[model samples]
Target chain A: MFHIYCPYCEEHREEEEFHPKGQAHIARPEEPEACSDEEWGDYLFFRDNPRGIHHELWVHAVGCRKFFNITRHTVSYAILETYKMGELPRFTAEFPEGSLSEKVTTEAEAMSRQEGVKA
Target chain B: MSNLVAQNIRTFETHPGVEISAESPLVFFHQRSGAPAPCTESRVALRERALLGHLILRGGAIVLDEAVHSVLGFGLPAYPNALSRDEGGERSIQWLSPDEWLLIVPGGEEFGLEGKLREALGDAHYAIVNVSGGQTLLELEGEAARELLMKSTPYDVHPDNFPVGKGVTTVFAKANLILRRPTETRWELVLRRSFADYLYRWILDAGEAYAIGVEV
Candidate 1:
């Protein structure tokens, strides 16, 4: 079983301790009033079911009880990244050292960027 | 007018196996004579009351360090998984997390001690919640207590890892408990109110082979 990382618990718990929440990187429409019906439909229902390197969200509902995103290989089940509820996932060639998504920056900066989002 | 004489008598039967003790901040249950105990009881191999005070302190440790040093005569422990004992060695405060602390004073003095801490803090962004009622303390003594805990929890409870004076919030037998060691022979389990009976029954079942006894 895959070991999922719980950001709140700050530990990699057994897969049994987590539950799949939904797709990640869901950006809210900046102006819903100005958007088309197709755009609204895409926002509401459309999601990527990618074969490899899919970034999906999961919740540590049984452990720390927090939501986080996981960049995992669907076939191999190898997780590339596990980020906190609101932070953006960074996948750059320069940062070749695959990190455990530690919050390496200031808390204030992270909090301000995610002001309207509910964690 | 002739008044009719009537006698009102109320009779109810309390089950002998379902013995509930007086309400304390915490309570424990254990069965005797190898008899089938109630479901609420943990059926633990052994159980006893841990007669110590427990208090939850919340605030920035850096800010509250000074007050704790002045009033308790010892600053907060620096280590994350450690506890600081007082001069008498009877009182201690364990760092539950970065922002939370579990303070244990002498039994029967926690309420007044909390008031003293409030006075000492003096409007700091801090909170001291009395959680004694929500939990009961179970003192697991005797030689096999350590082994029993190892079976109950996943954490390594060996003396090397869990030395005396250390406390940790860990899972124990399908439930959560704050485990602590006050002395060399004593181990404490801070169990929740709702799960006390379940845990108690589990303990009785586990400790049966060891010939563990129940204290009240």
Candidate 2:
């Protein structure tokens, strides 16, 4: 039940309007023919499962239908920021302290407890 | 005349010139479900604005705005999720995306409008898709219209969040449709030809408590 800010629509829309695309900032190799087998495999299958600060690609499926980036904390489920395509995220793993990590950790713990109860 | 304007772009009139009977998207629904008469007890009234011209215009906002203004006498909406209508409100242009807008006009006016827009736009990159047959507009009004919409869509229909002159493509029930607030009391739903029946039934089910009626 997350309310995500769509950069294109310039409003916070319900989560149902959005579809989360995998990891963000994963650029394709310029020359696929030049890459080795391992490099190509990594490009195709590898994705970071960072615990603190994670960037994700999401599309406003029901709204503007445009793709954008979201800087979210995995545990807390707090979306620190959402930016349009071709934009960079302000919060990154290197700057974990700047993100809402502490608050999200508590929220994540509470959410897990709720999930456990429901289960 | 349109052929000379842009060979790469394809534009066509969606309506036929013959006198054959045409049915709106809701014809079957109205016939099957039977419309309840509009009365003081009916809190919501649904009506179909059938056979209207619906065009999906894709291009740079500035270029499309200039061309639309030159042809339709009204520019594209300036902001996202905003709708601009003619003084008479018979024609409207709504911003669907950064580069996409929906232009709706009275039936029989779309083909000429598209041609004129092509001529006005010339070589600028653009696309005008006539979706008149692919979709239809349903007008919902009365006191319970907003509540009916809130039940169908997850998007907030509160007057504060969805003010007049705003439109958005959103999930409605199990389907997706375009929802617009044209006035304080009236809301419009643009449903695809395939999903109209499902949505109409869903609306009726949701509006039953309010004594919803279909105004044919």
List A-chain TM-scores for all predictions.
0.74, 0.79
Question: In candidate 2, how many Å is residue A90 off?
Answer: 0.4
Which run of 10 residues does model 2 chain B get worst, by summed lDDT? B1-10
Full-model lDDT, candidate 1:
0.67
Name the candidate that leads on DockQ.
2
lDDT of 2 by residue, B1-216 (tens): 556675676555567768866678878977876877777899999888999999999989889989888887889888999999999999999989998999999999999888888898888898889999889999999998988887888898999999999999989999999999988899999999999999988988899989988887
In candidate 2 the C-alpha lDDT for residue A23 amounts to 91
B29-60 in candidate 1: lDDT tens per residue?
33223434223333333454554566888899
Q: TM per model? A: 0.66, 0.90
Give all candidates' CA lDDT scores.
Answer: 0.67, 0.87
The recovered share of true contacts, given per candidate in order, is 0.00, 0.93
Q: Candidate 2: where is the Cα deviation over 4 Å?
A: A97-119, B2-6
Residue pairs in clash, model 2 = A76-A104
Give the DockQ-based CAPRI class for model 1. Answer: incorrect
